[model samples]
Each structure stands twice: as C-alpha cells, then as structure tokens.
Target: MASTTVADGIVDRLIDWDVARVFGYAGDGVDPILAALRRKEDRIELVTARHEEMAAFMATGNAKYGGGPGVCLATQGPGAIHLLQGLYDAKLDRRPVVALVGQVVSTALGSGYQQEVDLHTLFKDVCAQYLQVAASPQQLPHVLDNAFRTALATSSPVCVIVPHDVQQAQAPEPGQQEHGIVVSSTAYARPRTIPDVDDLESAADLLCAGRRVAILVGQGAAGAEGPLREIAERLGAGITTSLLGKPLLDESLPYHCGVMGHLGTTASADLMAGCDTLLIVGSNDPWTEYYPAPGQAKAVQVDVAARNIGTKFPVDVALVGDAVSTLNALVPLLPAQAGWRPEVERSVTAWREVAGQRVAQRPSRLNPQLVVHELSEHLPADAQVAVDVGSVTYWYARFLRLPPGVPAHLSSTLASMGSAMPYGIAAKLLHPDRPVVALAGDGAMQMNGLSELITVADRWRGWADPRFVVLVLNNGDLAEVSWEQREMEGDPRFPTSQAVPSFPYAAYADLLGLRGLRVEDPARVGPVWAEALAADRPVVVEAVVDPDVPLLPPRQPEQKVRQTLRALEREAEGGQAHELLRAQRAHEEAR
Candidate 1:
C-alpha cells in the first residue's frame, strides 16, 4: 500500500526508477510534490537553485556526467519556460533527461490562469517524449513511469508536467505490469569489414601517383588516433580535422592543418583544393562548403554508417566498416609506397611552424581561448563536459583540449544555446560519480530562466548531492554565421564584437544557496579555480572574459595570401622558421 498523497505516487515512481536527483526550485505549482518529499525525506533530497534556468542546466550537467536520465522539476509559467533551452540541448546531444514541470491546475486548463502556458505544446519539438498528468487517481504513476522510461531508453530528453490539483490527489496504480522501456539499434549502423589486399593495393597505387594528398577526419574517427597518425607519417599528407574531431590530432603535428567547416581555415581549404586526393574517415560532416566548390579533388570515405558513404559530397571510393580496422589493413598498403613520405613531410612541417604560432595567439581571460584552457585543465579524462552554442563553441575547437576517451557533447544540426544545462543534467543523472560541468555563456544561461539551479543541487537521491559545476563565461551576447552570410558579408561584426552590460551573477548564485565565486582579475584565476575545485560541490565561477578575443585558426597561409587570411593561417608550405618581418610584406596586398 502506497501513501495516498499525489506526491507519493510521483516520488514512489521516481525512487523505483532509481532517480537520485531532481533539479529546479520549489514553488506554488509544484509544492505538493516538494511537501510529499519532506515526509519521505529518507528517499530523496531536493536541490534548490535560485533560478529556474540553473535547475535545468544543473540537471543537464548531471545527466552528461552520470550517463543516464537526469530529472529536473520547476514551477509553472516562467519556471517551466526557463527549462526549454536545456531540454532542447538534451535532445540533440543524445543525453537523456526527464523534466518534471508543475502546472496551475486541471480545472483552469483554458481559463488563462496566472503563469499558465502550454508546456506540452512548447515541448513538442524538443522532447523525445512528453506527458501531462492532468487526470488523477489512476493516471499519475503511469504518466510518470512513461516519462522516466522514455528518457532512459531513447538517450533523449522527456517531459512530465503535473497539474497542481492532480498532484495532491491519490495516484492510481501503474497501468503496465513491468516498469521498463525497450530500445534497439537501427539498421543503419556501420558494418564491420576488412579491406582486402587487392583494395589496399589499388588505394596505394592511387596514392603513389598523386602529387598532393590530404586526410580529413570526423567524430567517428575519434578512436583511430594512433592509426590516423601512422597513416599520416607514412604518407606525409596534410592532416585536416572536422569540427567534431579537432582535439584528437593536435594541429601542432607536422602534417596537421586545421578543422574543416564553414568557420574553418582558408589555408586548410586552399591546401585541400591543391590536393589530388583526399582520405575521409568516420564522419558524415554536414558542412562541406569548406572543402571546395566541388569537382576540385578526388575523395575516399570510410565509416561505420554505410549511408554516409556518398551522402555528403561526391566520392571516388566508399568503404563501409570500422575506421580503425579498415585503416589497420590500409597501413600495410601505405608502407609499400616508400617514396612519397619525403615530399609530403616537407610541406607539412613548413605549414605547422607558421600556422601554429599565429593561431596560438589569444587572450588568457574569458575569450574562447581562455574558456578552452580552463576547461581543458579542469575536465579530467574521466570527467564529462557539456557545451552550449555561441562564443562557447568557438572555444570548443579553438581552445579546449581533450585527451582520448573524454566525451564532449555538442548540438547535432541546430546549433542552439540553453542546451548545456539539460545535457549536463542527463550526464550527471546517468553517470553519478563522474564530475559534471556545464560550459555556458551568460546570455544563454539567462535566456533559459534562472530558477532551476536549485533542482540540480537536489538530484533526488538519499544523501548524495552530486555537484553540477558550472564554468560560465559571461560575455553577455549571441553570435552566429552561415556560409551565405559569411560570403554576402556586409560587415563581419561577430556578435561578440559588441559590448554588453553587467549582470548580477554572484548575487543570484548566492540566492540559490550555491557557492558563487566572481573573478574580476585575471591574476586571481589560479587561486579562485583551486577554491572551486576544493569546494567539491555545486559552484559557479563567473569569469568576465573579453568578447573580442579571436578564434585562432590552426592553419595559416605561406608567405603568400596574407591579405586574404587572418594572421594565423598566412604562412608558406615549408617548415623553415619564417621571418615574420618579410612574411608580412609578401602578402601586404591581401591585407
């Protein structure tokens, strides 16, 4: 016999599913659920944040860090509205999180009650599953169970909205016999296959004949770091990474050029254009306008998903299977061609010296570079990190560095903000013991609502309050660029180029009962960072970073196209130490 209170049914189901945490602050709409938890304090503890937005973000961080479904609750109206950005993030990043929202009451469904907004309708686009617990007695537990199971099974976000009246009533028994969800792998998964001796021989024959060759990698190519390096060493070809695969192979490598995307390097694209053949592995990177205008170079792609073979751009050869295994077979074929390495090595070394230095120049504070540096050092190999869009993304490829095996979550198609929190919640929920962090911009955090910070602290389980450490770079703005706009180009005023007003980050953090540390001085960064780490609880380090810091490109032009590119990618094709003085003069025209 369960307790008759509506809160009991909700809490019982959450406990049964092993939900140890719930994000969001207590309020008028969801007070029943909070009060019920007070009676059953032995089962779950509530994390209270000052802002509803923090609750969702904290939940998102926990979800990514934990590797399961994270739960967050918020009041109706603005509170529920605040959780939207984080919810959207969980959906695209493929992290699972369950959102518990409060509603005014069933009786006032259409009467336009205070803080009355249709959360179901707003959530339709982002939630993997959404359910409203309007009717009481028999439907409450069933709806709660469905929301929980759906979030866990799909590795996506789900929403469960409980109306005020129904939440106080007795919950009816669960409709289903077993509380479980089902999942299956899609048929589109990449098949495993070994490259035959004949195929390798054919590939080697082509490579041996080509004067210039390049290798392009994607996220799917992550684990093949060793194999990728081996191939580059043997061939002496330029190594260009996709946005998803930048950190795996540092551009400092002799052959490394840059990340390939619309916002990627012109020199990388230039070198790629000069290539006779391009080797692609493990990713179907959607943005290809960076490669060339098409019909420019021959290409070969290999991946686990076979459909990605000819999907993005035209390819001369498409191999379907595991990239690592396929590359392993291809290595023997590469060593067979001995003469090409010398020619390729010469060009690779030259580009590295000039490009690496120019791109490395960046501000040490809150700019994208600093964001990358702080996160790289703070996020352990075992730790999980969730990224939000905007200037934060520039930091992703330009600054933050991750070692092998670290999972960095990002948006798939829609590069939207407000997603870091939900993804973080889902990570922490699933991977409880892991340290979860949300890398967000101030604007993104605010646009989503500020009350959910409390929800992250409460992660719902007994005594363990898993922390959702937020490293927020408050530049206070939004930034975007499409190829058409980058080309149509009136003014390249990246939103970050504009100035913004100050917000009360610390005051709000303290209000939420969260440890808030504000760093106004660059010199204080080291000590404050140590304090946050030492606190070992939910904390927000509001670092005021410069908005104008440039995202340094990993590739630069040779003493050639200085005018056409920014300082970083403006060097020539040899590894010789360039005379900075003369190099500037050579391309003074392009500038």
Candidate 2:
C-alpha cells in the first residue's frame, strides 16, 4: 500500500472538487505543499503572482467570474497578512473564496519561531470559517473539504491553516481508515430561496396600492432581469439600480433610470424621490440619505438574507427569498397601471440629454466621460467590464451602458483601488470567448499593483480568443481625493493630493510584450481604444485626461456648495484661482 503525505491528501481533495487552479507565491513555510502542487501540475496549474495581495484579488475575481469557490495559497505570517485586503474585497462583495495558509512547524509554534503568528485570530473577522494547525494527516481531507464547502455555502471566504510539519506527515494506508471520519461529498450548489405565498401576497398588495412604484436593484438580482422587467412593466414602475447592480438590466430600457446614490443619475434620484411605493430587491445600499424618506413611501424589500430585508429602511412588506423566485410569484398579483411610465420616460430622456452634452464637451485634455462613453459604443454586446474605484468610477457609473447578459464587476462595497486589472485577468481566464476590459485611474493602477499585468501577458498564450484590455485614465493625480478635499473640507489642493508623477504606463505594457497604445489627443481616444480591442494579445490603452475636470455629484448638498465656495475664496491668490472661480460659476449655473 502506498502512503501519501497530508499535503498530497489536501491536493487530492481539491482535485475532487474540480478546482484546477490556484494563485499564490511559494515560500519556505509552504515548501511541502508547493512540492505536492508541482507533482500534480498536469492536473492543477499554479499561477504565481507578483504579490500575495494580487493573488488574493485574482482568486476573488476567479470566483466572481467562474461562479465557483476561488482558491489562493500563501505562506505564514506576512504572506498570510498580505491577503487581507483582497480577502476583505471578496468578503464584502459576497464572493466564494478559499485561502490556504501555511504555518510554522507544530513544535516551533508559540516558541517565537520564524514566520509564526496566531493566524486564526488574524483571520477571524474576514473568514466565515477558519481552521488552524491540522493535528494529523487524517484531518487534512476533512479540513480541505470543509473549507470549500463553507465558502460555497455561505458565499464568503474560508481559511485553512496547515503547519509545516503536519503537512509532511504520512497519511494512513488505503484500507486503514479512521472511524467517525467523514469527508464532505457535497457539491458546490446554491439552492434558490423562495418566499412563502403569504409574504408574496403581502408585498403585491402594498405595491398595487401605490400610485407610482419604483424598483431598486442590486448585484444579488443578477439573473432575474426578465422577471424584474415584467413586474416593472405591469406596475408602470421606474427602475433604479445600486452601483453594484448597474449591469443587472439593460441600461437602454426606457424605464431604466440608471444608478442611484452619490454616483447616480439625476433621473434615478428624481424618480426615487417622487415614487409613492419603493420595491428594493437584493440591495443593501448604505446611503440612507439618498433613499426615500421614512413614511414618505410604502417600502417592500426582497432579499435572500432575512436580516437584510428591513435593515436599509422601514419595510411595509418583507419578502425573504431569492430575487427571481420572489419577483416571479409577485408579478401576477399586481394590476396593470400606465400612470407612472410617462413620467419616468420623460425624466430619463432629460437626463440623457444632459449626459450627452457632458460627453461631447471638449476640454484642453481628453474628457474621461467621452472615453468611457465611446468605449461603451464600441464594446461587444456581451462584454464584461471591471471598474476600479476613483474618478474613473464616476465615468463608468454615469456613462457605461451595459446591455442585459453583459456582466460587470466592481469593488463597490469595499470601494478599493487597483482591483480592475486582476478582475479583468480573471474574467478573461474564465470566459475566454468574451471581451474583458478593466477601467482604471492612474493613481489607483499604481497603488493596487499594476505588475499583475505581466501575469496576464504570461498566460495569454494559453488562452483561446483572448480579448483582455486595460484602459487607464492617466490624469497624473489622485483626482477623486482632490475633489473630496475641496468639497468636504473647504481646503485648497495640497501636495499629497497633487503630486503623483506621470508614468509611461503604455510603454510599460509594451515592455511586457502586450500591445500598447497611448493617446494624448481627445480625437485619438476612440481610435486607440478600437486598435487595442482589435489586438490579438492582451492590450493596454493609456489616455491622458484633464486633472482639472471636477466630478460633481448628481445633486450637490448645501454644505458641499458652501465648502466649495470657501475653498474658492481661499485659493483666490493661488495659481488655480481663475480655474477654481470658473468651476464654481459653472457648478452654480448647472444647478
């Protein structure tokens, strides 16, 4: 009988789960596991990332794009610690991920040995389930199985920590099985949570009673677009989406009012304010101030998690179920009403006119809005977009129109920077037939780590019909932070917000052997994007945009206006005085 090592057992279990890939860095603490991974290279491929954080981001992206539990591995201490940011991104986004951490030898633990730390306590908050110091070889299979199972079942991250010595121990012979040891045989599946008939009837009654109804959606309503559309058409409702739910429906639909919140559209904000009844589906949007005021409207909420049903606002009827099932059951109970459709259509038309003018406005440098809008026009109908957080997010949220069936991923909940590139790579890896683009800002690209672009370049040769593209809005500063400081604190631009050096990102892409294009003229933005999209390999397009363009909110708060006025007065004697005065005038005139 052949005896296998605990590390081998763990790898075998991963194979059983059909997880053929892992992203991580190899280090001394994880040598045994690395060796096992090498032996199984034909069956499972290891993607070595430039940083552990990038590995975690890649894993999270994999889970999101592929619809399975993403796997990442890292060594003890610093390596494990580096995975937190990406792990938190996965946790907050509610994606399934499994992180395998290597620990110090069992004997060396608590003896101040090198690379030893209490990983369980470190990961307690981020992980839905955590396991540390697997005592014996027999426990390896169970630990691996449980990690994958918990991650998939809860749609959250799970961590399994293995000691170096424990992983090297020999497993029991094939016939000598331990009693009471049961390895999980559960497959990765998410059963729909349907609401009870009473709950559905109650929600339908509340919705039917209102004169004007509006539907608000989030990422959890991903596959229920048809049902949602049917219900909205029946009730003559306007549809507004949270930032994460922007791609859930066709943006070109007449009743679609676009995103709602700070980065939302004027039409969406207006529709939500005027509605008599609001039906929220699968969104826990935290911006309470943007929602309809309490007692102003009757609210109905549908969510898989019972705790989230009424947490965002007071609900008249709470239907606790999956978005598709609940929407399907409630559509028949409502009567057809044509009262609200015309009002919503008019608002949407007016908002689109204003947006069209903004997109056509020519600045001294390229307009970020035009770049995103033009990209949207040229994008394939089924393209997938991953947007990084920053001013770039404003352009994407406001201008990029995704048709139904086109998926989009963003770091909305955690609102992290530098996630676009990793997400693009993962999306491309999983769906090689579709076009994937990462929209990022210059500062965010540098902060989150752009070296991962090389990972995409390295793997591009193996991909079928690879169409990965990275579009960078290189404005040479942290534009979003600068605008926030001026709007919130009445402060003039400082060194920290205005001192990012412009790097040759397109040239860097060329050095990595990926197709690269740089556009400084506004006229060239569309042409360059077209060329990048047509490239056979991974490509990057860097467009120089104006840093002076302010990202104004949909509706500027009074306090924000006052702060801007104070900031303009303070900068009266500075070099930007004339520019600031012009912006202030334009802002006032727009309102």
**Most lDDT-accurate candidate:** 2
Residue-pair clashes per prediction, in order, are 83, 0
**Model 2, 1-591: lDDT tens per residue?**
343788887777788888878889988878888998998999987878888888898899998876478899999999999999889999998888999999998988889989888998989999956554577776767777778878887778989888899889987554444576655554666787888898888888889888889899998887889999998999999999999899889889999999998887878888878999999999999778788877889999999878787888899898888888888888888888884999999888877876876777666778888899888767887688888999999889999987667778888899889889888877877777888889999987888547878788788888777778898899887888877777877897675556578799888889998877988887887788888888898788888887666677766676776676577566543334335435534543463
List where candidate 1 sits over 4 angstroms from the true fold: 1-7, 36-45, 111-116, 128-155, 164-166, 173-258, 262-286, 296-311, 314-356, 359-388, 410-413, 417-488, 492-497, 502-591
Give each model's whole-structure lDDT: 0.63, 0.83
Please write out the lDDT profile of model 1 over residues 1-591, one tens digit for every residue.
856777787887777777676777878999998987777678875766566656665666666554346788898998888888667666655557888888998889989989999888877878845655545555666666667666765557888788898788865444334445222221122235666666666766666565577888886676688888888777667777776676567655656666666545544655566677778887667776566457766777777666678778787777766788888877777753343445445555544344344334334344344445555556566666777776667666544667556666755445766667666655665666766667777776775524445556555242244556777777554433321122233233343443344687766777776778887565566666667655646778787775444332323334222332332223231111123323422332132
TM-score of each: 0.65, 0.95
Give the range where candidate 2 is weakest over 10 consecutive residues by summed lDDT: 572-581
